[model samples]
Target: MRDPAQDPDESGFGFPAPLWRAVARRRPLGLDVRWRSPLRGPWLTSVLGLVLLVVLPVVTVTGLLSYSAYGPQFDQAYPGDVGFLRLPDFDWPTDPPWLYRLNQGLHVGLGLVVIPVVLAKLWSVIPKLFQWPPARSLAQVLERISLLMLVGGLLFEIVTGVLNIQYDYVFGFSFYTAHYYGAWVFMAGFLVHVPLKLATMVRSLRGTSLREVMRTGRDQTRPETGPSHGLIPTDPDPPTLSRRGALGLVGGGSLLVLVLTAGQTVGGVSRYAAVLMPRGRQPAGTFPVNKTAEAAGISREAVESWRLTLTGGAVEVSLTREQLLALPQHTATLPIACVEGWSTTQTWTGVRLRDLARLAGVTEPSSARVESIQESGLFRAATLQGNQVDHADSMLALRVNGGDLPLDHGYPARIMVPAIPGVHCTKWVGTIDFEAG
Candidate 1:
């Protein structure tokens, strides 16, 4: 039997308040006891980690936009007939189909990185809750409310994020859409959380080094004094750094494992690749085509005499569509992601964007512009700045999923940009001018 007088938390994992108090004051066990950055070094690293969090959605959005905006392959693989009821206007692909497997993999991999980095930063600061200093009463209440909001929002995001990763559905909705929408919520909470954290960091860094204070042991008995001391309350006796360092190392390592392994386990690289083109099958044609092109009001002849222009700030001259195709045709199998949140893997045969840049008298492929003809009848342009077009993974795609140009997709030629949004992968064969920008 446990002593009822001694245990309060009752979990028996650690000593209770009475025991700690006895240790602190050399008083009886019936009593209670307690103890506890210049925010710069640790806080700087913490903020960098936060910045990485912001980049997560940016990366996902870029990749999705690259594939979805155009492609006959995308239409055939995930038909629009299965559009979501809630977002009826948009096509939603949530089945664990091959393309979805890989798309979800990237989504979950990026998310796994978010969990640990956030938790480590949180752990470093939670102890200071007790060390919280006296503020204006109203200010303190508001600060407390803000913290609660941050915590609540973080919990909601993390829970939903983890569940989605595990292929678990919470509400009666598709995890993909829910996860994307939840990301905005998480981002809102994150934006709110940053200012509060900045305030905390300012308070933390306003003082002398925490190491110096702890070394002098001056913080063990009294309230901190001077701007060097700032707002952290002095504990009667605080815990040591040795344990904290070990715990931080453990937490950081766990996060790293999650980050590196995610691309393999969750992203579905092998399966997506296999399904989009399949194995041991001769490809059917050079471009993605089907009946969908007619339905979309696109014509079959639009592909003939297709030209890709290359001109930009980096180059003194531009090349026309004929000059580009005459250069050399390079090909590879790459994945495409749509803004509507679906993806497909296909074999793309084309002249490498780099090769075309070189033939166009471009000594530097870094500064280039590729334009896409959108369904809205407006051209969408993206700069291949600073070795972007020259990148080995970026190409002018003429074939998809082991087949010829299907009319709905850019028939004679298209662009394929790997590891970015699908929007960057323009469908129609057009002029890509190489110039410095």
Candidate 2:
């Protein structure tokens, strides 16, 4: 409906003017401007937004870096539903072996740590969601739409990510695909939201000081006087909690979340404190198993018949477990890091991938597809870029820490690349096929 106060003779043509008037005249209970929440104000929202501004970019950039680490250019990343949306082509680096470890750790850890701030920020500005007129202008309408994406996309990403971390998949969708797409959706809204709100956040925070907020009590708690921005209430009730208390509640919750979840990323003794993180619950000694052979549907009978097949050009060699062990063995210390935020580094003794490539007469191979015996799941196979294939530290490990690979740890053979994501390591290796790009 056209606001007669602003356009006395204008008409809201082609719109449901009467229906909108009905909604505006008798607003929904939640949308009522008289909402009596003393803590809901621009100041609270800006503070939370300020925190998010400082951290959300880190989470987002690392999330992208985490995805990029999978080598989408080589078609080795998890199967995201749409291929066109893939990141720009580039050769992922192979040095600083801990690259993926650090990227993934920050991605998962900071994503979880920022939840309380996100929730508090949403709570602070929820009143804006129920504006009576809904959209005052075309620009406002578009902003509201972006806001919808921002909130919905964020919640979807967070819930799916957390559920995946817990190994819970009640949603019945592939977490990798959903999270990958949802991140882009969230980023779209986030990019639009930041510039729109940056000025407001700065304006709201201009005169507010940390010292002033801490000293204020319920008696002093009040909405900042000025443009309400739909957050300030027309009829605020007596404060049930002081501003400092509210800030502390949100800040403390974030700290607690950081403590519990950061341990998974930090690993070692602190891992014991990560009760909620599955990978951290048990220490990953020399052999840390993310998925056991049994869980992966690998049975004793399966590995008993397991044979490593190497194929490239005119060479095709099938080797039994003994043959692989008989080939020269090399040991390298590397970390096995998973996307679920747990990692362990240990000595791995195995056939160098480059050596295995030469055994197949596949020198200068453009790529290598390592397949596993596991009957199902995405990890059953992974393709490695030439860089990953040629990395001297990359290998097909037959033993770990001077012992045979544990059945749960890929018994016969498993691929281990210094910086590759654990899932791409291709555990329970059954075949290695070299490709010419």
Candidate RMSDs in order: 15.3, 3.8
Q: For this target, which candidate reaches the highest TM-score against the unseen true structure?
A: 2
Find the 10 residues in a row with the least total lDDT in model 1. 274-283
Please give, for residues 363-429, the per-residue lDDT of candidate 2 as tens digits.
7888898889888986788888899989988999988888888888888899989877888888899
Model 2 whole-model lDDT (C-alpha atoms) = 0.80
Q: Which lDDT tens digits does candidate 1 get at residues 52-145?
A: 4575555445334323422222342122333332121223231222343355445545545556655655654554344322222334445556
Count of residue pairs whose backbone atoms collide, per candidate: 48, 0
The deviation in Å at residue 360 for candidate 1 is 2.5
Measured with C-alpha atoms, the lDDT of residue 268 in candidate 2 is 74
- Clash pairs (backbone) in predicted model 2: none
Give Cα-based local distance difference scores for all models.
Answer: 0.48, 0.80
Give the lowest summed-lDDT range of ten residues in model 2.
Answer: 1-10
Error of 1 at 416 (Å): 1.7
